[model samples]
Target chain A: MIICKVVGHVWATKKEEHLNGQKLMVVRETENGGGTYVAADLVGAGIGELVLVISGSTARMALGGNNTPSDMAIVGIIDNLEMETT
Target chain B: MIICKVVGHVWATKKEEHLNGQKLMVVRETENGGGTYVAADLVGAGIGELVLVISGSTARMALGGNNTPSDMAIVGIIDNLEMETT
Candidate 1:
């Protein structure tokens, strides 16, 4: 999973039928200035929250096998990341 | 799906049991000098072929829902890509 921050929302009145009712968000990877991509919200993640995203086909699995043509999905809301001072 | 060229192969004898019997190949995205990632080969793609890859959980779907921890899989071989000259 990649770390991302919910930046904004994406809406379309007409789109793929399977994509209806899906909440789309614009997210940018948290590290290294990764490019942004549209992701479906699986968890109730909010804007500016750190989220865990699983992309590609794994993302579609979150839609109950809907095959929505989306390649990214927010999978979790991360609380923190602690590193060991080794 | 991303277009990539097969650069090399990876082998791990000891790994998640679910990952056993999976063939791993190193791929470089065709458009950008995108960093490499290990991808499971679903098609019998060769070393020099340009391939279409579906990554993340979609990759695991190629494994029959085994939930194999893989994140990328080669979905097709690219024979031609035609674009209109406008």
Candidate 2:
């Protein structure tokens, strides 16, 4: 589970069968409070929200498959994310 | 399965009844190869397309769900990815 910020969204007219009617979103990967990559959205996230993204076979399971051809999925919306405050 | 590269997209209209109509994107995290995190297009990726992402609970069964809040999903679509040139 990686911590990220909602940054954008994606649109596709043609896609895989299992992907039909599914939402996608863009989230910037964060680490120690900073940015990393820019990815297409798989969740309905809005800018500024902290979110949790899952990847790999785990991502496949999130969408309910081992053959859906997906590798990432947003599975949670963090109401308030906090690290250990020293 | 976290090797990635796509770069953009996102849109929304009220959400979270299991995130009806999902799609999102953002930026980034990476190590040795460069670039780290910018996610959101649960696959159906374009741009400089080079992607592979998955996350926790196998991203909740890849969408079958352990209570469907979604952690991330984009199971697979890497026509070609290679490392090791020594």
DockQ of each: 0.07, 0.08
Q: Write the per-residue lDDT of candidate 2 for residues B1-86, one digit (tens) a residue.
A: 45556566655576566655555554332333565443445547766665555555554545565665666555434454332211
Candidate 2 chain A lDDT trough over 10 residues, lowest sum: A32-41
> lDDT of all predictions, in order shown?
0.70, 0.56
For all predicted structures, in order, the TM-scores are 0.52, 0.46
Among all candidates shown, the one with the greatest lDDT = 1
In candidate 1, stretches whose alpha carbon ends up further than 4 angstroms from where it belongs are A84-86, B1-86
* Candidate 1 chain B, poorest ten consecutive residues by summed lDDT: B10-19
* RMSD (Cα, Å) of model 1: 9.9
Cα lDDT of model 1 by residue, B1-86, tens digit: 88878876654443434556877776767665454555778898878789998866667777568355456788899999876545
lDDT tens string, model 2, A18-66?
Answer: 5556655556666654443333345566667888877666666676666
